[model samples]
Target chain A: MGEIVFQKPKSLCDVPLHYCPGCTHGIVHRLVAEAIDELGIEGQTIGVASVGCSVFTLLRA
Target chain B: MADKVLMKGNEAIAEAAIMAGCRFYFGYPITPQTEVAAYMAKRMPKIGGTFLQAESEIAAINMCIGVASTGKRVMTSSSSPGISLKEEGISYMAGCDLPALIVNVERGGPGLGGIQPSQSDYFQATRGGGHGDYHLFVVAPASVQEMVSLTAHAFNVAEKYRVPAMLLADGTLGQMMEPVSIEGITVEDHDKSWALTGTDCKRKHNIINSLSLLPEELEQWNLERYKRYEKIEAEEPMWEEYMMDDADVCVVAFGIASRVSRNAIKAARAQGIKVGMIRPITLWPFPKKPLLAAADKVKSFVTVELNMGQMVEDVELATRCKRPILMANRVGGCIPTPEQVLAQIVEANKLGGAQ
Candidate 1:
């Protein structure tokens, strides 16, 4: 491997995602994060995580 | 707005709720809607929000009620069976005029229905799932994209009307993956004037409850709530119409069923059958205006549902049967295919043409 690059989407927080393979949770997570980033409310915004497979990934928001 | 991402309906709802300023989430693990709870659990803590997985559906909804009482934006989600368990709390939330988002990723029926998509909850959702003469702001999303937008809209409607709002999605819509572009909203810019966060000189302590011993007082409360509903009916009705112009027949459906019906309409039209679709975005309001308008042009109407015929009754009430109305549906976690709906439309057209 030439190089390992890690770039996080501005919409997503620096948190590990726990969704299963082929899961849409990551996509939705990015959309929400992007919406927050576009709206420029990253600091003031708060999120509520649910209890399904995505529960462990809440820290990313 | 350009980049599109594929997502499930349940996950989309969680994303939309967060973007809509939902700071509190309380829910139990339930099939078809477990992703919503899981999404919240992982995200709430990092954002300084609260997410609690209650022991049961009842505990979940009541926890929602408690958080909502504090004037914090809150939400909960479940599938058919779990939603059934949360009915009492839902009714109480309505009685208290509390604003909160409740998503029901609907599955099959009267009991512990399977984890497949179904619209059997039409009566339960639109007729007030719990006991009482009250109604909720019920929105049915047909796609994963609509799921995100509608979930955000649900929060706005609930806050504006001071009522509980529900996103009624079926298993197909909940589980299907689709591209969605989230755009044009700021979570922090929402108005918090009506929140109950310990009044500071601008207002008195807000008491949110649903108990009134006096019959007269309760009656007055009901009347007031009805007035609010009337205002909503006049201002907040939402729906979508496809190919109604010069069509001889119309199919009325919502959620996943309506999506199939849309494809059915296209197929029928390709076969020289004049068919159209009327999809109600707001199920409680029932899109009476457009349905009544379509009734005038179409000779017959076909009501498609995942359940027996719950919304068909509303269709009949709206159209007043000036034209014949037929029902086509599936039950017990079954979903009617486009071919089934197309056949119904063809039969309706044949009958109308014969007459």
Candidate 2:
């Protein structure tokens, strides 16, 4: 059996998320983190948690 | 981010707005700034923001006004003709004291003149573009980087002062590509106490209209708005002085023309000429104090611009005609080369520039 290794994006924090099951916000958040990782500009980004459900995504990140 | 990335001025404005927590954008497409709309169109949805391409520039600005009244960050961008079309809503925004970012990637002419880079909209922008005595806090970004910083800064200023602020850039600055750092000083989450978030029985209903039709009441609102404008002028005069420490000739310019003049100053200085520059980062505040001080020291002034000397009048007012203020400008979409400005500098020097 091949060993499984997990690597998280540097732009995303390692924390448990509270998004609803099968919510698209999770995918959106991961893609945002992935883009930030790809650009290698995580430190320069300012994440704005709007007054909505995505505010939790900001918190989880 | 501290890391610099190459970006067009228009796209930088869009990205910077996102960094500034602007989730609402309403604009119509017009060159040389449609990239702002395009960028927002792509990014806003991903961030759960609204990016609406309205029917016309008129509809776009009204949509911005609607979003701004709700106390969320919103913006709109247009070129010369499109901005002229949206003047009514701009005035309404000013009258209502709504916080919104209005960007004018300016081009030439009194009408739908030319699409090439020009600074012909200085008067329309600085003066009331819309009717009434209301003022827009006009900011000019000479480079792609400034298009980001000043666009972000416009949101802060607008929210703080509860007024509409304009990011005034010409076509050259809009289309030009340069490296910009998109890190710190971008997103600022200001308290939206004045926004019309639902009362929920906790506070009074917030009124967000500019229609105080009674003569006495409307006059009072005008007076109050004037007071705020005065405060802005007093507090927000921003500029950059280059080589003015010992410069004999002080060159006045802004936006793309200032960049050209900067190169001219550098080249002329290598030839032992004393030419300097004063670039106003904030067009509304106009940086009169330092300009007056430079005018006191320098013998004469050379105003370089893409238009036929609209800003020279403001410089004249600042200097009070104490020195000879000459202009080297181009119109109908032609930007004068550095050589042309260098020649103008040599002429101004010979004509008692820094004596």
Candidate 3:
């Protein structure tokens, strides 16, 4: 089989996922991170996370 | 028709709140401002609004929190002691960026103080009585007419900034009766897209909690809130100047004290002493720009208040100590007479002249 090329998006920080496997949370996170990176406002943008599973976005996102 | 009617100050404020689209009212009974609740209770339901006399001031403000989260106008009124108890909830509202109107018809205080008019709460209102670096949009109404006008304005300002606002009237302004013109005044329109009604399973859920546990996240929130404050200060500073042109002395006052200072300023000018008055309508922004401009035209400044010279600090800071500042103060539930303020103005004038 041919070698597969896969890489994590630079918009998200390199950290192990804290959410469960097949949680569908990583997909939503990547979408938002991609938007922020595309808009070039990653420096000025602020993301607020609420209680529950979203608290993991604090330092890892 | 510009109809005029005689109404007590407290009742006028309550009517103005209803006219300003305040659909939810939650407050406990306190002296001097009890008329506000009594009026709201009789009037709120008649207008298809909600009036809840909560078990305590704390409970009343928390109820206000719930209503504000729903993006509808809510209000609560209390006297000084009751306001002290409401500090926690008021700060929480600020933290949550909720829009609500809070009225403090102040009485003498320190601990269950006398039920008399006093400006002792000036520092409390201007300096974020609750907690954190929050700043309230505070309005000081000097007359019965202003009691109506400013109450309506407070709600508009509150909604615009999404910050809690205060109508900081003293006991006298709340209890006195005068002819006020509220003809055809109605609640202004507002956009409630930010309000938190359940999404009906159509949109994302909204949370109205004020808990930001991490230090860096909380710091960012505080900075964003202060950016709004800076914009408000630039756009919303309001004051009224009387006979300030070509004056050597200026008398600064607000609320009942301003009424007395006006009499004193008239008397001082009658005796050929150059005196003027500045009535601050918004207490938080503190009218520093106009006051600093006034400093250039005058050599002396004096402040009149019902407290032991609390607002004098603001005057000194505003004037930058370039001019001498004097205080005409009365405490223990008593107010300074016009003559006392005039004496201070004259005294300040002499000192400024010599220097």
Candidate 4:
């Protein structure tokens, strides 16, 4: 598998994924995490999770 | 600023809200607008933000109110029916003069109209959805790009005016995909001096409430709020005027419908129809000045919408019947296409050029 490369989000900590195939959730998730990383606000963040597919993303994060 | 990437309107709004320093998101599941909630759910946690799916639309908006009271940037989103359910909470947020972002990817409705895009909520959004005399800073984004850009602007305006703001989208706008870029966003540094994050020892305790038992006191509060609105009307009104300089007919529309109207204007102009478009970027302050100016030059105004003719009334009031205003619209999930709009332009031209 050639070391199974997976990059951790710049601002977001490494976490597992629970998204369906072809879902753009991962991309959007990265963008938000990258934005926080760029702004340097990782420590003070407090996220709330809604129901549905977002629940998995929230739990993983 | 770089090459834009393809993104859905709902996704763009979520990304933009994060870039704008929004730290809290509370929303209930609803069709069309579910993508916004979905995006926020995945992203908020990684950014150390709050994302909660409230029990209902009412609870969602109230959560936003509570978060906003703490001077934290918060948002809530829903479809038309759910938005109606949040009316009371929306009014309360307004009464308290809390700054927060609310998004309604409107669907057809007097009640649970459908899970399809509709502009039937135009009056509800602009006239104040909840009971009471108040105005929300309403921004109507006609494209996915505008969704991204205006979501950021909505937060700025809300914070600036100390009032709840709205990003009014329709099902088409929420669902469609387009390229967008959010390159240079500096969210770390922002002004939050006016936020009610505990008054601290430096000032008196900050209380955010919309209640005033005394008639005279209530009157004073309302008068002050109206002044804020007047300043917003003067300063925040925004619109896109396309080929309106010498337009014989000016078509006015917003949200997803405006994009279709833009296409129609292009097609009509290609045929020497001399049609143009006035796309309102902010629906609340309603961009009346530019519309009134366009009315003076154009012979007629065509109001294109997804619903029967809700915003047409506003156009008429803005133009003050200086010109004849015609409406080309669709209902339910039905959308008025470019061909339909062009047909309307031809009819409007025959009726009379510009009034």
In terms of TM-score, the best-performing candidate is 3
**What tier of docking accuracy does candidate 3 attain?**
incorrect
Candidates 2 and 3, the one with greater TM-score = 3
Cα displacement (angstroms), candidate 4, residue B307, comes to 1.0
Residue pairs that clash (backbone atoms under 3 angstroms), model 3: B19-B187
TM-score of chain A of each: 0.70, 0.74, 0.76, 0.70
Using all chains and alpha carbons, the TM-scores for the candidates as numbered come to: 0.82, 0.83, 0.85, 0.82
- Candidate 3 residue-wise lDDT, B145-168, digit = tens: 999889999999888888999999
Using DockQ, give the best candidate's number: 3
Native contacts kept (model 2): 0.00
Separate DockQ for every predicted complex: 0.01, 0.01, 0.03, 0.02
Per-model RMSD to reference: 16.1, 14.8, 8.2, 15.1
The runs of at least 3 residues in candidate 1 whose Cα sits more than 4 Å from the true structure, single-residue gaps closed, are A1-61, B186-194, B200-203, B353-355
lDDT of 4 by residue, B280-343 (tens): 8999999999988887787888899988788998898999888887788999888998999999
Candidate 3 global CA lDDT score: 0.87
Reference contact recovery of candidate 1: 0.00
Candidate 4 stretches with Cα past 4 Å from truth are: A1-61, B184-194, B199-202, B353-355
